[model samples]
Structures are given as structure tokens and as C-alpha cells.
Target: MYAVLSVTDKTGIVEFGAGLRKLGASLVATSGTAGLLRDAGMDAAVIGDLSGVPEMMGGRVRAFHPSVFGGLLYRRGNASDEAEAHQHGIPRIDVLACNFKDLVADDGIAGALDSIDIGGPAMLRAAAKNFPSVLPVVDPADYGEVLRALGAAGGEVAAVDPAFRRSLAAKAFGRTCAYDRSIQRILDTTGDRE
Candidate 1:
């Protein structure tokens, strides 16, 4: 299975990627994530290699390519979608493991709020939108469940189960809601309004 591991939170990610690799899955990641995986001795291919585009603007322009989106959004069983993906050289993305940047307030500035990722959110939303074809995982806590499912399925947990897909959709929506709330709170505090 092709597993994409792009996370702002580096918690347990190296171990998770290593475990996934050990379970016979290909690991794909962005710059920092790829570095972490390599540092942990896990074989991870950089997203740029797949997308053929280097990270630009302080790692802002990574994973925004058609290749990445096609992989995450295309339905495997649909002949048209699969054909289109093949024509565009897009590999199927089975699992998307991601976590939003943790916003932390410090010295009258919110570090985590500032670190809100644009590309990460877009990718997560795309994966969640195509949940029938893609398995989107936002919480590291769900790693064990995923691993268990993969093991049970003989190292092929690419298909998103109905129940798990619903859970992932809920989590994705909650994450967006939380991000909006943070922005609202920041605006409320900074703006001059009653």
C-alpha cells in the first residue's frame, strides 16, 4: 500500500513510518517528514520525487500538485478515474496519515495558530473527500487500529471501511472547525470590537 505521512506534529511519526515500512508499505512524505523518517532509518521517498517539484516558499508549495491530488482523490475501482490517473502517472494513495500543526500561544503570540498549514489542510480535505477510495487518518492514536487492520488484511489495508471512513470524515470536519475557531478567537482578541 502507498502510505503518505505528512504531519506537522512529529509525535510518534518516525516509529509509525518505520512500522508501516516494516509491514511492507511504501512511505511518502514531505521535507521535514522525510528527514525524520530517514533519521529513523526508515526508507521514505520525498513528495518532491513523486510530484517532481521542489518545496518552495519555506515548504509551502509541497504536495499541491496534480500527481498528489490525483492519487488521493481518484477512485480505484472506477475505470474512468483509474484510467485518468494512469494517464497522468499518479500512483494510488492508500493511506494518508496527517496531523494539523498544534497551535500554542506564547508571549502574546500564538505559535501553533501561526503554524496553521495550508497545503496540509488541502491534502487532508482532499483525502477525506475521497474517503471511499482513500483512508484518511488524522490522529496518531488511530495508528494501532490501522496497523491491526493492515496485518489482518495481510498487509493491504488500502480500502477504507465504511465505519472507519465515517470516523475519518468526522475527524476531518472537526479539525477544520477547530481551525476556524482558533482564527475567530484570534480575530476577536486582535480586532477593536465590543
Candidate 2:
């Protein structure tokens, strides 16, 4: 199983990543996140490794690749999807653990603009949209519960309940919606002062 983790807020990420690794999940993470996981003594593949592009454009271009999205969004049962995925060498991303930078909490226009996360939200939404095949985890608090669920099923990703996956998808959508609203509000207020 493959788990993609690209969280800006690294509250309990190391422990969670370690737990996932112990459960036989290969971890693919953003550059900083991968470094942290490695420092914690857990090996994690960098997102760039999957994307075939080094993190460039001020590290903003990470995870905006077909390999990442294809892995998250590939349909399990569809023959064409399976063939395309195999053709592109896309591995299935069974789990996504991500959190966006908080635009609402930024102190100023510069901070807000800087906090506008693009790739993170896109990946989260893709995982959520494909929730039946991928587990979407937006909040750090959900880490323990997900680990427990996976553990209960002996690390089988498909063993997670459909209802639970739906709930996680809802949460992922909620977070992305709130994040977009925050960005809109900031832009609106910024324009008013201009």
C-alpha cells in the first residue's frame, strides 16, 4: 500500500508516518515532510521521486503531477483506467494525509498570499473524490483513528468501512471549502484597501 503525506502542519506526522510504515505502507511525502520522516528514522520516498521533477518554483510545484493524481484518482475496477495506470506506471495511493496552509490565520496580505496552498488542496480533493479507493485524511486528529482502523484490518486498506471513508471524504471537502473561503475573503478585503 502507498500513502502520500504532504502536510504543512507537522504536529503528529512523524509518529503517524512511522505507524503507517510499520503497517507496511510505503510513504511518499513532500520534500520537507520526507526529510522529517527520515530524521525520525523512517524512510520516505520524496514526491519529486514519483513526479520525476525536483521541487522547483519555490517548492510550490511539488505534487502537481500526473503520477500523484493518477495514483489517487485511478479507478480500481475499470479496465481502461487500469490499463492507463499501468501504462503510466502509476501506483495506487491508498492513503492521503494532508493539511493545507491556513490562509485565514495569516497576519497580513503577504502572509495570506504566501499561505495560499494549491497542490495540497488539489491532492486532498482528488483523494476525497476517490474515497472509495483511497483514504483521505485532512486533519492531524484523524491520524490515530485511521491507524486503528488499518490495524484492525491487518493493514488491508480495503478493509476500512465505506462509511468511514465517506466521512473522511466529507471532512476533506469541508477543509478545502473553508480554505478556499479564507482565500476569497482575504482577496476581497485586500482589494477593498487597494
Candidate 3:
């Protein structure tokens, strides 16, 4: 019924968010992404606003809170989980959209360090781990497919096949692996120079 978005790729996000809005889904996004959604005429709340934790460490730490993970990780049919979620005011996040910042060749150490996303991979993994309850989208290319699925199901991604959800999860893992490898390369290179 709700979704979270924290993406570096703005391509097609506006259209995707707008499509979701039409399906009556609320959006939670990082500050920068939220502003872009609003500019595109889709109302999106900042992720910090939902968790009541402002971005700290120069916007590097914001999405790892209980509220965010609880929403994505809660078991759909578990009464205990439901009770705990309600007690903590953790709303269910049916979808999570994120595309990590790409470390460009021209970007020096400063830029590469900043480009390494801490919360994004965590979010993607969580949502993928809880698929059927949460759909994790890590590529801009998948926007249309998601929107179409939402539209077909009248906003309920539960209608999607479990196989498809697994595929999505697999893709998310692949992306996270590549991202972590990139960060590792950076650390190795830095250490070499040191």
C-alpha cells in the first residue's frame, strides 16, 4: 500500500511515482529525491520525516532505522509482527525503489567516497528478502514493469507471481554484489596508495 524510494537515478522516477500515486500509493523518499518527486507533481515525504531521524553524517545515514526496516521486514501474516508494527507505528512498505550512485571514472577519491551508498543496498536487500510483501526495484529500466504490474493489480503487488518476485530479488542481490565490489576496489586502491 506504500512505497519508499531512495534513488540516484532520476530518470523516469517522476513518471513512476506519478503512476503509483494514481494507484493510491503513498511515497517516502530521501530529501533530494522527494524534492524531485514534488517538482514532478507527485507528493513524496522525506524518509527522515517518516522515521523522525534527520539525515546525519552528511546525509550518509538516514534509511537504516527501525521504522524503515520494520515496515519492509515485517511478516505479512504474522499477528505478532502486526501487533509489534502497530505498536511502533511502522507502516508496511509494499515497494522499495533505489538505484545507487555510480562511481564515475573521472570522480576522484572524494566523489567516489560520496558515491558509495550505505543505506541503498540495505534497503534493497531487505525489500528483496521480504518479497510478495515488499518489491525491491534497483534499476530504472524496471520502472515501467513495476508501474504496469501495479496498474494491473490495482496497486497490490501481491498479485505478482512469486517467481517474478524471486527474479527481482535475484537482480537486487546481483546489484548489491556489484556495488560492494566497487567499494572494495576503492578501498584496495586507496590502501595501495597509502
Candidate 4:
């Protein structure tokens, strides 16, 4: 099993990652996130390492690769998707724990614009879109619930309740939508609405 985790909010992440590790899931994360996990004595693969693409553009272009999205978007039971995934060596991403930067941060206009997360929302949406196979976790508060569900299913993602996954997916979409709205508001106030 694989879990991709990237977040601007670091609350409860180490514990959540630990739970996932205990459940036999391999952890993949952005460089900063991976460093924190490693400091916590947990093994985590850097996103660049998994995607075969180094973090570039001051880390803005880290997780926007096909390798990462392919893992999250591919249909589980579709033979063509499976074959293409195998051909590309993209592992199945069974879980995604992601949260974006808060636009409310006391950063200036340039900083606030930078805080408009791209990769986080993209990955979250792709995982949520494939909720039948992927578990999308948007909030840290729900980490324990997800861990419990995975534990109850014996760490078998396929055995997890579809309703639960669907609910998480819905939450993921809601989060992204709110994030975009915040960005739009910021841009509007700055007189640079696009």
C-alpha cells in the first residue's frame, strides 16, 4: 500500500504517518514533509524520488507529474489502466493526506499568491475522483478516523467501506473549493483578479 502526504499544515502529521507506517503503508511526501517524517524516525520517500523529477521552481512544481497523478487516477479494475500503470512503473496510491496553505496567513500579496497551492489541490482532486480505490484525507482532525478504518479493514484498502471513502472524497473537494474561493478573494482585494 502507498500513501502520498503533502501539506502546509503540519498538525498531527507525524502521528498519522506513524499509524500508516504501522499499517504497512509506504510513505511518499514532498521534501520538507519527508524530512519531518524522517526526523520522527519514519521512512518516507521524497516525491521527487518517486516521480523521477527533482523539485524545481522554488518547489512549486514538485507533485505536478504524471507519475504521481497516474497512480491516483487510474481505474482499479480496468485492464488497460493497469497495464499502462505497470508499463510506467507507477505504484497504486491507496491513500492521500493533503492540506493546502491558509490564505489567512500574515504574508504580503506576493507571499499570499505563492501560498495559493497548486500541487496539493491537483493531487487531492485526482485521488478524490478515484475514491472507489483511493482514500482522500483533507483534514488532520480526521486522521484518527482514517487510521481506525484502515485498522478495522486489516490495512486492506479494498476492504474499506466505499461510503467512508466517498465521504472523504466529498470533503476533499469541499476543501479545494474553499481554498480557491479564498484565493479569488485575495486576488480581488489586491485588484488583480484574474
TM-score of each: 0.87, 0.93, 0.92, 0.94
**Sort order, TM-score high to low:** 4, 2, 3, 1
When sorted by lDDT, best at the front, the candidate numbers are 4, 2, 3, 1
Question: Local distance difference test, per candidate?
Answer: 0.78, 0.89, 0.85, 0.90
Model number with the top lDDT: 4
Q: After superposition, how far is residue 17 of candidate 1 from its true place, in Å?
A: 0.9
Candidate 4 C-alpha error for residue 110, in Å: 3.2
Worst 10 residues of 3 by lDDT: 101-110
Q: Pick by TM-score: which candidate is best?
A: 4
RMSD of each: 2.9, 1.7, 1.8, 1.9
Model 4: ten consecutive residues of lowest lDDT: 185-194
List runs of model 4 lying over 4 Å from the truth.
105-109, 192-194
Judging by TM-score, tell me the better candidate of 1 and 4. 4
* Pairs of residues at least 3 apart in sequence or in different chains that clash in candidate 2: none
Question: What is the lDDT for 107 in model 3?
Answer: 59
Clashes of each: 2, 0, 0, 0
Clashing pairs in 3: none
Which residue runs of candidate 1 sit more than 4 Å off their true CA positions?
102-114, 158-160, 192-194
TM-score of 3: 0.92
51-71 per-residue lDDT for model 2 (tens digits):
798888897788888899999
For candidate 1, the TM-score is 0.87
